[model samples]
Target: MNRRSLIKAAGKAGAGALAVTALGGAMARAASTEPRAASAKPRIHVGSDPGIGRWSHAKSTSHEAGWTDQFQGMCTDGTYWYAVSNEGDNQRLHKLTLDFSSTVASLSAPRGSDHIGAPTFDPQRRQIYVPIEGPEPELIWKVSTGLSTVGIVPLAGRTPGSPAPQRWKCPWIALNPSDGLVYSSVFGDPERNDLDKYVDRVWAYDRDTGLLKKEIRLPSKVYAVQGGTFGNGGRNLYLASDYEEAGNERKHVYAYDFSAARDGSAVRSWGKVAIPDADDEVECVVFAHLTWRNARDTHITVGILDDGVFSGSTDNVYFRHLAVPSPGLI
Candidate 1:
């Protein structure tokens, strides 16, 4: 769809910041229809404190710092976490120890890598796949473990010579180690910032061939998917939303059966968890069992695009232990 058409679609859908205000009752009703495990209870709680492991970027306005956090993307290799930020002048990748206690290294994206979105890491291939978003956003820049640009992967839906009407922005990418396939969320409202009007879908692509295999249409309630990841060895898929209800700032996270999605079936909402926090613009989430020796003791680490326009603090990263669901339920 063209930019004009996209704006018209959003208007027809009544998607705007004001429209979200009325979604509370609608969202609750939508949640009630979701099928859940017989024994599933609310996984994430608010009053309790977050996880034990924590990290901070320490609000920095210095030009050399690149950017504190601008729609950041993150993934971990059990020991180190790779964070990618879209700094207008100097896009950078920061590798930090899992504990968020120390910076292992910092690398800059090659020139013209403008507006890099969230990325997925391939441990087997030792590569990081980053989505480059711009006026024409379809390229997935491949960076080696040594932080070198190996090549670029064009999105199947928006190939180089294709019409721009059908083009989509890849906001986040996730790798399923079980099948070694890459998954990404694509959607946009064109000129409008109203996420509700955007057409949303989840796509699965072959990492090696860059071939598009399947596309799953997301539910309307899911306005924007900012980040995603596979859990339980690719048995389940988790996606986090971008926009939230103004007052509460509680963004919903959806879980889907990855196996079903891989087989070309409509992703069923296995369950949903809400993250209640002060940050209204929750960008992405990745689950890693960094602390415990047992793999089952996994926890979720959330990233916030701290613009300092909303919340004063520029700390963009957070760890939520209580937000993690029971292993038995996932």
Candidate 2:
């Protein structure tokens, strides 16, 4: 069976039966099937401002059958939201209302584009920035907020003195308004499963010239960065790992001190919290001031593209609404 079908079968086989404790902790499972020591009790991180804010299971919403595809990244423009997905026949950039009540529009990725990352909105220009895995040198596309393609710019550089062949896929992006620089997470060797070969390296680029400004190697533990967004009024940066399976290590959303990373320092690992759902893989995370209309109340929301438990059903996008303390955003 194809991977999606297998995923459905895995869910029906008991994945859906997995439940969260009242405290939002998922039952721990071993990363491999071979017998091993008893897994330690899962650590439940709590508190309003414990680095990564304490998260609670809010709710989940499913997508339609035709919408069954890989969800990569997401972002909102206060008034509307955009999510990027690719694979199968569902490759497109989706535009939705803030509440996901409806899809306002959709745009097919440029021909030759293989994958698209979560989109970043350029409020000053009224456009959305989307990165893609494509052609010889990958490119970032500038699409109008209305979901129309405006133009594309070739990503102009790579990590220096690396022995690995240059193969680029820009899967996450954030526009730091404080300095007009674009930070992106790039992956190498798309076909390799060895995590180290394709691990993520974040780069800051001059928005006006698209020239590489600085790059920092992420900690070796961050296997891949699925999506990211600016937080703390654009002072801090957050990156999310796309999901690993239940038996594997926990998926995390990590926060970083932006200024340090920009100054050629190691991307300091600030704080992180495990996403609550054990069965699903979190495709990406987008934080926006979606509640209370206050900067302090910005909430973190993640898109689960592959977690499902029901039988005879195709998995749709499942959004887990997370509640982080308002004081934490500041």
lDDT, candidate 1, 1-330, per-residue tens: 111233364332110010000000110001112211123222422222231112221111111133345536576554455677664465677776444445667777656653566777776776777766555535667877566778887666434345223244566677776677777755443345654345456677776556666676654446556678766456566777655645656666666665545444565556556664625455666654323322223345455554544443333443333324343333
lDDT of each: 0.51, 0.54
Residues 59-78, model 2: lDDT tens digits: 44456543345566566665
Model 2 ranges off by over 4 Å = 1-50, 53-56, 65-68, 158-166, 187-200, 243-248, 292-298, 307-314, 327-330
Candidate 2, poorest ten consecutive residues by summed lDDT: 12-21
TM-score on alpha carbons, each prediction: 0.68, 0.71
Report how far residue 330 has shifted in candidate 1, in Å.
3.9
TM-score of 1: 0.68
Clashing pairs in 1: 1-165
Alpha carbon RMSD to native, model 2:
11.8
